[model samples]
Target: MSKLLARIAGYLSNRTLVGVDKLGNRYFTRTEEIDGIMKEKRCVIFKGEGDPTSISVEWICWLNGQRKRAPTAEEQMELEARREPVKQNVAFLKQEEEERRAKEGSSHKAKSTGKTGGPDLKSFIHQFPTEGNKLEEESDAVDRGRGEDEAGAQKAKEPLSE
Candidate 1:
């Protein structure tokens, strides 16, 4: 019904029916001058739902000028084949993340940060070891060189309280 009306409208408006999808959506185009430059005016009159999302990715590309024309059968098949790996990769990542969460510490399973609004110090320090934090390593070495007894003796050597 609408297709017939579209054909009539196309003829009257000088727009040509460029392509039709399997779902019955019709793509129409016509040449019109915009800013004195002749350009092809394109639009899609949806068949049933008229929803933009109903347009296939390939059709969307053509409509948006990413493609010269509607995708061929081979191109659609190739796209479908390519999607298989991406879908599998996404599923694998989700499963791996779930396993990580299951094995992770309960504290990490909740919020990663402390109550002070700072990063999780334990996790951060563990991930990036003392190798990168030379200051902390040096402080530890100095503390070890000066034993607790020696530290106490050094403090005692200071002037007595008045």
Candidate 2:
């Protein structure tokens, strides 16, 4: 009767079971035996959380102590890196893209229209270097005064009421 009890205990201890979720997470449990004799205790071989798709069934078996392969520290780190959470700000990214597009469109329209002196504004200043020329300074001052005058004129043209 003792021999039969010992054999039953041993068989139970040596048995292994594994459970997996849809997300590839896995859990493994096994019965433990000591000195060829089955014990009434159970042990966890592997209890990991992550996408199971990244880990193979064979790897899981090894992790559970059912197979011979042992996981190394490097492997563990690599798996951890893969499982790390990714941060994304989709709304902010989209807003930035839209602003960039609007800037491009306005710049394109400015180039196409003869407004703002077109492209000659760049080369003209380069060709006529400012070298203490009073006339050039006066022209710039006049341009500024003229801009203010135009704004004032537009305001004065508005209908007046008593």
Candidate 3:
């Protein structure tokens, strides 16, 4: 097919190696003349099974032309190192919060009416009749009124015997 031939031709064309990700995927770019204008083409060569998810955000941005330059190894390393401390801090805070909640949950079991330690508005609201109940009551009253009107109309239609 012409598309397959074009792909083969593109692979054969001279492409500059931009970067290699931690997953061993290689990224490359090439310039080609199309419609009398020079355009840049980018592609990735997977190291193994070609899983798209294996690509990092930075490399994805470069591949999609969202970034002007490919990510450097130093930048990636620095970001990874920075993320480690943040992850540790998050875990520590979560554990601390869980411990506090456990203590409060045991000691204030009766005092706590809800999650916010305030009156449960949901239960309070349930004590009142709902809109559907109100509507049914109103309709019953109207039906009773209609019955009275019918009875009065029959009386008015009766004649007096003198």
The candidate scoring highest on TM-score is 1
lDDT of 2 by residue, 1-162 (tens): 999998888677645544443334444445556799864432233345434446654455566557654445466567656655432356667889889879998888533544555455677676675777867888999999999999999989988877
* TM-score per model over all chains: 0.50, 0.19, 0.49
Ranking by lDDT: 3, 1, 2
Q: Evaluate model 2: give its TM-score.
A: 0.19
- Name the weakest run of 10 consecutive residues (lDDT summed) in model 1: 105-114
Candidate 2: minimum summed lDDT over ten consecutive residues — where?
Answer: 41-50
The residue-level lDDT of candidate 1 at 4 comes to 100
Model 3's TM-score against the true structure: 0.49
Candidate achieving the largest lDDT: 3
**Clash count, one per candidate:** 0, 4, 0
RMSD of each: 12.9, 21.7, 8.1
Worst 10 residues of 3 by lDDT: 110-119
Is candidate 1 or 3 superior in lDDT? 3
Q: Tens-digit lDDT track for model 1 on 8-101? A: 8767886787788768899888889989999987889999888888888998989888888767667767887898899999999999998878
Q: Residues 97-138, candidate 3, lDDT per residue (tens digit)?
A: 989988988988635544756666898898777876886798
What is model 3's C-alpha RMSD? 8.1
Model 1, residue 54: what's the lDDT?
Answer: 83
